[model samples]
Every structure is written in structure tokens, then in C-alpha cells.
Target: MKKKDKFIIIDGNSLAYRAFFALPDSIMTISGIITNSVYGFTNMLLKIINDNKPTMLAVAFDSKKPTFRHKIFKDYKSDREKMPEDLASQFNLIYRVLDVFNIPKYQVEGYEADDLLGTLATQAKDKGIEVLIVTGDKDALQLVSENVKVIFTVKGISDVNIYGPEEVIDKYGIGPNYIADYFGLIGDKIDNIPGISGIGKKSAAKLINEFGFLEQILDRVDEIPAEKIKEKLKQDSEMAILSKNLATIDCNSPIRIDIEKCKLKKFDEKKVYELFEYLEFRKLWEKIKKMNLMEKSLKDENKFQSRTKLIVEEGELINLIEKIKNLKEISIQFLGSNNDCTGIAISIKPDVSFYIHIDSKEKEDRFFNLLKPILINKNIKKIMHNAKYQLKILFKKGIRLQGLIFDSYIASYLLNPHFREHKLSEIIQKYFGYIAFFNIYSNRAITIYCC
Candidate 1:
């Protein structure tokens, strides 16, 4: 027997809405594009992709037109508030991001995202594809079964509670199949769907669990021990049935499932990086950069040319700083972590760069003492990639660099923003069409120098 491949279906609109609310609306790029919703949705997306390692994926979005449920009641989800303009603005960007990832997205004019997900999940499960439906809606729990599970966003965007049929039973005191029936009796106030006038959760669950489904419960409503409960069920019988119909997800959406199109593929890194740059999603880019595929993509390092001369001795460091003191423009790369840096690399020209090892206190002191003046001088331009990181490393040594004339990182951000990393290798290959070759040692700092 072979292991089954997993197919992950997502409710895009619901999760996007959930994400918009989960994060602060103030999350925007420097250019002033709101990204909280996209951030939240992407985080959930990356988490699911990484955690599940699903081989097939699809995201179903809701159409603007009313679904069949609305046609049935005209008031289905009518009470729900319209989406805010801020959230509406992010949908396009989110869709662009999805397209960059090569993930298939589906939307039908007459159905909700959940309905599409339910349909796809059913098809996937029947075909022996292990199906996982990811959504922020509880109504999705109705689709949970042995082969199909629901990953429900519980509190925050990333925080989720997975529900199998057994979990659903444990949660609601009824099986997954009876979730719609439960809602039909109690009603969902969020959607303005009406149920029996006086029925509540406890009564709904008790009736659904005992008699199985709304129709069966209605068939035996006359035998209820409580007259008030029985009377409510009988009086609003039509409402109970209507709510059940409303609650039940249509597992028969007209949309076709294209497993080939949805097959998990390498994400378009350039496009994703571009979006991240425009969104000013620095941390998110770093996370994406660490993906295994990205790591593999970075292995093609033929374009890099080694540019720095290693300065192991204190005298060499003093000479390097002396050369920097007279230069009009210079680039420096700090080689170390936040706690401790091992060395620095300086590039005075495209081909002429120097590296200084700061292993000893005397060498470190000499390097900073000689270079500090040029950094503070208003004339000599300081150029570097991710200048803030270098500044932080230098700040750790009590040196405040001032002549911040150019930051390639900021320049690149202004230019494209989506390039994966501002490392010399990428920058050179991108702009100069050349490889930037440099050796990275365990004991040395990682730095890129540009002039």
C-alpha cells in the first residue's frame, strides 16, 4: 500500500477577513499600503504549507454576487456588515501573492469560499487524497470526516485547532455530520439565519445528538418532555429546515478540481520578494528567504567574484582604516552576530576591498579608532547593504556612524523591494550581471562591501 498524498483547500475570504481582524489595521508599508490582512493570511498560508507539506493546494475565494443560500432566503448573511475598504484593498495584493506562488484559486459567482472548499474536499477525499480544509469559519467543521479534517483558526491568525470527526463530536456533543443540524435549531446570529424561536445551543445539540439531523428532530418534536421546547420547534418548523439548508455547505459546487494545476510547485521567489518589498514586510521576507527551496535556489553562486583582501594582522587593519579615511565613498560589511562580531570588510572600489579580523581587543580598538572619524565626517559617504544591521553591530562597540550617504538596501528597496536578500551576490547579479564571490568562515563575520 502507498501513502496518500495530501490536498489542502483553503477558504480565502473567510481567512482573509479573520486575518484583517486578528492584526492591527496600522500595518502598512512606507509607501502607505495597508498589509495587515495580507500579513495575517500569508502567515497562516506559510504555516500550513510548512507544517503539512501538502502536495496539492487550492484557495477558494467568495464571489461578490449573492450565493444560492441568499437566493433561498434573500436575508442570508444580509445582516453581516460589509467588508471595510481597508480589507477590500488587500484582496488584490493577496491574490497577486497567491498567483506568484502558483497556487490555484477558485471563485464561483453563486457560491461562498467554504462551499467551493467543501466541494473540492469531497472530490479529493473520494479520490483517496488526504484532504485538509483550512478556514476561519466554524461552519467548515461540518465537512470534517475520517478522511477529511478541518484546520480551524481558533484565536489568532496562526493559532489553530484541528478537528476530525471525533474532535467535532467531542466539541459539540454531536458528530460532524450533525453540525448543520445543530446550527439549524439554534441559528447563527452572525449570518442573521433564523432557527426555532427559543432554541439555544444546549437544546440544539441535545436534539441533534439524540435524533440525528433537523428533519428527524422535527419528526419527533411532539415527543419532547419539555412543552416549551416542543412548542418552539413545532411553531418554527419551517425556519428550522430553512436554517439547516442555509448552514449546510454545498458540496456540489460547479467548479472543477484541477489537481495538476493545484499540485504544489516552487513559488515564484522573485515575484513574492517583490510583493514583500512593496509591502515592507522585512521579517516576512527573511522567513521566506529561509525556505528550503530558496536555500536551493541560492546554491547557484557562479556570478560572485571575490573582492576583499584578508587583513589578519593589526598593522593590516590600521592600513585598511587609513585607506578608508581619505576615500569619498566606501562600503563595509560587518561579519558577526548581534552579540559579537568577528571582523569587518571594506570596499573602496568595485574590485578593491579589504577585510579586517577583530579577534583581539587591540585590533578591534585600532580598527574602530581609525575608522570612526571617517564614519562621523560629513563628506565621506558611507555605503552598505542593510546599513542598520551594520550600525547595530558598530553600536555594540560604542561607535555611532554618521555619514550615512547611501544604503544599497534602502536603494534596492526603493527600486524593487522584492529582491530576496540585499547580499552582494544578489545585488551584483541583479544590477551588474556578475557574480560576487566571497568566502564565509564559521569564525568570521558575514559582510558585503560596495562602493
Candidate 2:
């Protein structure tokens, strides 16, 4: 048999809510934008993608409008508190993250995310595809079958329990199909579904296992062995039916499932990097770099070509200085430390760069003297990765590095203070999608200049 295509459906609202409460609210950006929910959600998403490697994936989000359950039952989810302002604010950011990952997201006006997940999972399962439904809601377990599994979040965002048909049976003492029935007999306080008054989990499972469904048990109430249980069933038969209706996930929700569109594909690296940088998700950005899910554009490749000129002759050095003298800004990378200056790389333009080797003290002195005017010019701005360190090296040589406008290392640190080490190679790879090759041990610097 051909290997089945794996389809992963996420309950966006449920997972986001879980994540919001899982992490502390102190996880904020430099601008005080709280990102606990987004960070946790993205972390969970990355883990799922890395673990399952699903062929197709999508996230189903709940809309602001009241769903069909609310229409049928006015008390549906009425007991739940209003969403926190901080968590609500992060939803759009999470959506942007999904877009960057090239993952399609769906939200229907009158349907909950659970219904949407059910619809997609059922459709995929019917087509002989393996379906994985990710949610914190236990109601999703009803969707589990031979080719369907429910990744139920048991604790916080990280810990989870996977429920196949067998696992569902093991847990509930009933198959996945009777989950709604079980909930009908035992009310859900969270959703405010009024199940039978006297029935609990054990009694609910027993009834569901015996009579197959809520209707069957209600119809055969007189045959029940326990008189008190039968009376409770009779008294709350209508409520039990309503509760089952409320608890049951609608597998035929009015949404189309385009399997081809849901296929996991390469995402635009630049856009993803921009969003990550904006959100200040340094660890996640680093994680994405390791995943290598980005497609390098031909433009990036064409714009970056190594055309390095080794300036050995004095005439060559003078020509380079004259060429870049009038430029408003330039990028410089220093190789080696202050004591042992090895070489210096300068770039006047994006594609044009030059490197001058400093093997002896005489050569270092001569190079600094020739380039001192341009380097010390306050009008001509300079950009470097670690400006402070480079400034120290330049200061020791009596060349005060002026017009230091941007320091990428400091910027990266501000973006993510939790980062242990903000290396230039990692920064280049994160933003430019280019693997910078240099000898760290030898203190060699590879400079790619861009305005």
C-alpha cells in the first residue's frame, strides 16, 4: 500500500488560550508588547512540524461572532471569563506568524475551531489520509479513528497525550464515537453544558458502553439496573440530548478542504525573518534557521557575489581610498584583536569590497594613516557588527572610528536579551539568509556590505 499523506489540523483558539496561561505574562518585547501566547504557540507549532513532518497542515481559528452552539443554548460558554487584553492582542501576531510559515488558516463566522478541525480531519480520514488533530479540548477525541489521532494537551503547552482509538478506549472505557454521549451524561462545567444531574464519569462511561449513545440510554431508561440512576436519566433526558448536541463536534462544517493548498511548502525567508525580528523572537528565529524551511531567492544570491580585491600594493590602497572617499557610508570588518591586527575589509558598495592584509606593524601603521581621514570623518557613517569592540581596536591604533551609526550586535541583544551570545555569523544568517564562513579562532571577519 502507498504511504498515506499526513494532515495536521490545529485548534487555534484552544491552543492559544492554553499557551497564554501556560507562560508568564512577563514575556514581553522591548516595546512592551506581550508575546507569551505567540511565543508558546510558535514553539508548539515548530515542535509539531518537526515531530510529525505532516504533508499537509492548517490552523482553524474561532471567529468573534457567536457560534451555532450559542444560538441553540444561550448559556453556552457563558461561565467563561472574557479573554485577557494581552492574549487577545497577540492573536494577530500569531496569524502573521502562520502566514509567514505558509500555513493556511480558516475561521468561519458561525463555527468554532473545534468544528472546523473536525470537518478537516473527517474529510482527510475519509480520503485514506492520516489525520492529526491538535487541541487542548477533550471533545476532539470523538474525531479519533483508525487513521485519525488526537494530540490532546494535558498540562501546559509542552506536555500532551496522543489518543488513537485504542488510547481513547483505554482512557474513557469507551470508544471515540461515544465521547459526546459520555459528556452528555456528565456535564462540562467549562462549557456550561447541563448533562444528567446525578451522572458522573464512571456512570456516564457505563451507560455509554451499555446503550451505545445518549438516545439509546434515554429510550431504554426503564431497563437500567439502578433505580436512582434511571430516575435521573428520565428527569434529565431532554437536557442530556441538548448537552450531547452541544458537546458533539460538527464534522460537516461549511468549509472546503483543499488538500493541495494545505501542503507544507517552503516559505519566504526574508518575510519570516522580518516578522521574527519585529517580534524579537530570537530563539524561534534561530530555530527556524536550523530547520532550513526557507527558499533562497535568486535576487539574494545575485546581489551577493565575492569580488574581493587583496590590496598589497600602496597604489592599490590609494585607489580604494579615493574610490570610497566621497561615499556617505561604508562597512568595515576588522580581523584579529587590538594587539595583533591581521587584516581589514572595506566595502564601498553592495557588490564591491576590498581586503588589505596587515602582516607587520609597518603595514598596519601605514594602512591606518592612509585611511584615518575617511574613518575619522564624522559625516561618513560606518556600520559594523560589534562597533564597541571594533572601536576599541581602532582607538588603540589612534584612529578614532567616527560616525558609528549602527551596531548589529547591540541591536540583536536588545531584540532578545535572553540570548547568551550574539555572534555576527548567526546575525548574518538570520537576517541575510547567508552562511557567513570565517575563522572564529583566527579572529577573521567576513563582511557583506548593504545599505
What stretches of model 1 exceed 4 Å from their correct place?
293-302, 305-344, 356-438, 441-446
lDDT for each residue of candidate 1 in 271-325, tens digit (9 for 90 to 100): 6766665677767766876776332332244333354567787677667777777
When summed lDDT is taken over every stretch of 10 residues in candidate 2, the lowest stretch is: 439-448
**Relative to the unseen true structure, what is the C-alpha lDDT of residue 254 in candidate 1, on a scale of 0 to 100?**
95
Write the residue-wise lDDT of candidate 2 on 1-451 in tens digits: 7767999999999889989999999998777899999999999999999998898999999979999999999999999999999999999999999998899999999999999999998888888889999999999999999899999998889899999999999998999999999998898999999898888899989888888888999888889999999999888788999999999999899998998889999988778878887887878977986886887641344344446666777789999888888899888878778686777878787777777777788888888899899998989988888888888888898888789898889999987676678887666766666655542223545343332
Q: What stretches of model 2 exceed 4 Å from their correct place?
A: 298-302, 310-331, 337-343, 348-351, 356-387, 391-451
Candidate 1: deviation at residue 61, Å?
A: 1.1
Residue 312 Cα positional deviation in candidate 1, in Å, after optimal superposition: 4.7
